[model samples]
Target: MPLSAGPHVVVLVEGRSDAAAVAVLLRAHGLDGEGRVKVVSMEGVTNVARDLRKSRDEHPDAMVLGLYDVAEERFVLGALRRAGVPLEAPVDLVDHGFFVCDSDLEDELIRAVGTAVVEDALDEMGHLERFRTFQYQPEWRHRSLTDQLHRFAGSGSGRKVALAERLAVRLDATTTPPPLAGLLGRIAQHLHP
Candidate 1:
């Protein structure tokens, strides 16, 4: 599974949710991501170095982009630095085709669409009642609505991935969170530049 054999660029993400979100954004912006870009989920942020090495080894000339949580910026930066990308700051990472989510992809989406809209999305997806039940739990009851929503999404198996796909589809280019927008723009530049 050489990335170079299939696509012009690779977008490495922390997990499936990030992959799904990136794919949806690329498609929303009119790029044939499935055909032209390879989105790989390293499965965890800690695997950045291993994944980057593998992708580069397999596709020496293919552009590599990444989306990661801000909490994992150090790991991503260290990996990039080891790979010879001279990044001095988070913004510098963006210039090199890596974007960091503020807290994580879920947080970014919640902020982009707002709690009300996300609640509506949950309601539409038939998860609103489940979410409400989770919120009423003793430990969760005191947390902020946003925090509850974030936890609820990650609590259930595959819920984060499912919600990410739905949320990404509901977002347009204008409302896309900054990190996601930057990642897509970086990919577009690589594809068209």
Candidate 2:
């Protein structure tokens, strides 16, 4: 079914990588653009308020969920306020407030796809050594490999879909951080409910 024409849960981020990761998480859990969910990024937070104000205008009836690292939350929230979004409104705000550790989503990608695919993807991107170095950090040792990959994929929708397909092969109907089944369930709930 088609999503309604209203403001959806809009997740605004700082870059394509973070956008991709959040998208993957949303898709995996089954939230989408059929009027219930949407994802966007500002590239830079300087005028994010203006951008979200524009989104508010476009989808006035829906909620807006904003996500940016805590480092930039002040600026991002200021921008949104400048754009006329009310500060106390739940319909207009949500942020995880921090960048993923290990430098970027690539770390999570490496964790998810395994060393082989991670290395292959990096080699394909010509950043193999850089990624390898990052992967070896002590902090990364704490997170499960799959969570890392999901974090990378969840940064944006296109990558989310791509990663979801890959994860689908490895997961079953029940899983946290969402498996494909989780995504489908959300879609069904949103579309049918």
Candidate 3:
């Protein structure tokens, strides 16, 4: 469908977890993301090219940004190229508003907030005991705390998004993961400028 007239920003994310994380972080940063910014889950990074094309056609005047795993840089760069966004190299991604999570959004959040903060969020959600149990599982026993937490966050149904939102809620805007924070900053700046 056609976009409504005037300014809007579209934040394309890889999945529900990223979508939930972005929306929560924007609010945490005191932005009404739901107002002029829309967080869309593209389902998979490979589909970025298609979605970019569609968003361009449908919202020709809207600013488009995205968050992707660092591992998916090639796909994002290719998508941008296909969608007619000129880029000299991968480093220009942010100049065009895209941000890269360290490995993935979950990993970024886990590292940004640190072990204790993440544990506290898990505890607040009543999942700390379950997480402890997960760590003791045979395959997870030898993993690092970060690895265990990352995997545990995605292990259960709806758990990934739930954990993402919880982690974002627990984070102060100043301490937000850079990629997520950058996305919010770009959105706010674009909307106001």
Candidate 4:
């Protein structure tokens, strides 16, 4: 679909899951971004530079912010640098309108709500038993619960996006994970301040 027009800020996320999570959180916090803010998932972390450049080229006056996984911080930093957003490190990039997820959005959400709660969420989705079965496999037996959960969430196609949407909907606004909260706050500040 073609992007909406006029003075809208663009929030470049790594994928649809992040986009959905961000969208839900923004609405939860009372920020109506349907037309004023564009949450575009670049499809992958590797596309950060290209996406940023494209957004800038298409919407020169629109403010741009980025959300990425911590593991891809270097790529984000390089993208920001190439886009002329001055920064020396991941933390520095935040002030330049880029936020890094700890490990990834799934990791952040899992940590924010805790594994038990996530399991409860999975149970609600009728996948908790399946997840448990996956967890008991020899290869996953020694992994941390969080790691196992993360892996399970991504193992099936569309699972990550579904979980992200459901989890974001389930999250309490006041207790949102730092990276998400910070990204929303930055978007709010940019749009309202």
Candidate 5:
């Protein structure tokens, strides 16, 4: 049942945080794709094109899915094209089993779960006051609290990944971020089909 030993789905994500977020959600949903679904972190969006190619080459029979930031859509789309997917536009991503985050996964979760909920989660993690300090920085002081939260979470994948797991655990069907939720559903279909 190892990922490399059977039929599986290969997920290409931008970073560990993206990987962490999706993995946590998948488990929470009881998808149990550990052996059949692999989440591959390319570590950066810039590597999408190359990573996509490599993944397909390595697992030609596996379904390849991806989650990418809006700012990095070009890279994902370019990668899809290079992979021989007939993508006509960004919306076409979902049809190909890829999803785009508005800005990034952090932003999508923050917006879906809310700034206050995230702050509460930070408080539970004993990092609320520290996040308060982060918010007071000159560069972030004037931004919206949600924007500050995104920046704070994006500061490190450690925090981002931890928060993603925490938030996803608290997320019910109504609160799950569209991309993450959609990705989970896709994973389910792939495994069950």
Candidate 6:
């Protein structure tokens, strides 16, 4: 598949939750990512590398970005590399990407949504005790409960937005991704200009 001269940045994730977080981030960043950043998530890591490889082959010239957890980063990146993905190239076969966190897209959501709202939301959802457990679990201990709640909320766009809106009700300015605006624009900048 030859690269096309269009504006589309496909974002492959590990699950629907990750897709939702990226979707909201795109909205918050004023990037319309819903359309451009196509979220093709799998049930587990086994199919991630495979799916990415297939997408890359299908869109050889397009900028296909894969975002997932750091735990599987090494494996995914290695898979892409083995599939002839040129990480250093300006517009290579695939834009190999990943994030570091206990949960894949949770950290980003926590960072974006803040703490108080998260705690309240989790309390509303009746997960306060489990949330506290996550807080004391060493790795999750350092991060604020609110942020952890944001990550949990970000499991899906419907859930994430509902949580955001609820939080917004309490405070204000809980900005979210406006579908596929900024992400498409950014991809355009990278591919075109």
TM-score of every model versus the real structure: 0.92, 0.50, 0.91, 0.91, 0.90, 0.57
lDDT per residue for candidate 2 within 100-171, as digits (tens), equals 223333443444456566445546544556545545667765676554444444444465445433433333
- Report the C-alpha displacement of residue 44, candidate 4, in angstroms: 1.3
Candidate 5 per-residue lDDT, tens place, 30-134, comes to: 776446777899999999988888888888888899999888887877877887778764357889888989988888888888988999999988889989999
Cα error, candidate 6, residue 29 (Å): 4.3
Model 5 scores a C-alpha lDDT of 0.84
**Candidate 2: regions farther than 4 A off:** 1-7, 33-35, 83-193
Candidate 1, residues 16-131, lDDT tens digits: the string is 98998888787778776456788899999999999999989887778888999988988988898898877754356776788889899999999888899888888987899999
**Candidate 6 residue lDDT tens string, 111-191:** 445675567676886666766776687766677555556555654446654554444334324433222223334555654
* Best by the lDDT measure: 1
Worst 10 residues of 6 by lDDT: 172-181
In order, candidate lDDTs are: 0.86, 0.51, 0.85, 0.84, 0.84, 0.55
In angstroms, the error of model 1 at 16 is 0.9
Q: Once model 3 is optimally superposed onto the true structure by TM-score, how far is the C-alpha of residue 60 displaced, in angstroms?
A: 0.9
* Candidate 1 residue spans exceeding 4 A from truth: 1-5, 87-91
For model 1, name the residue pairs that clash. none
Over 4 Å off, model 4: 1-7, 88-91
Give the Å shift of residue 100 in candidate 6. 4.3
Clashes of each: 0, 21, 0, 0, 0, 17
Better of 2 and 3 by TM-score: 3
Where's the lowest-lDDT run of ten residues in candidate 4?
83-92
Please give the distance, in angstroms, between residue 62's alpha carbon in candidate 5 and its true position after superposition: 0.7
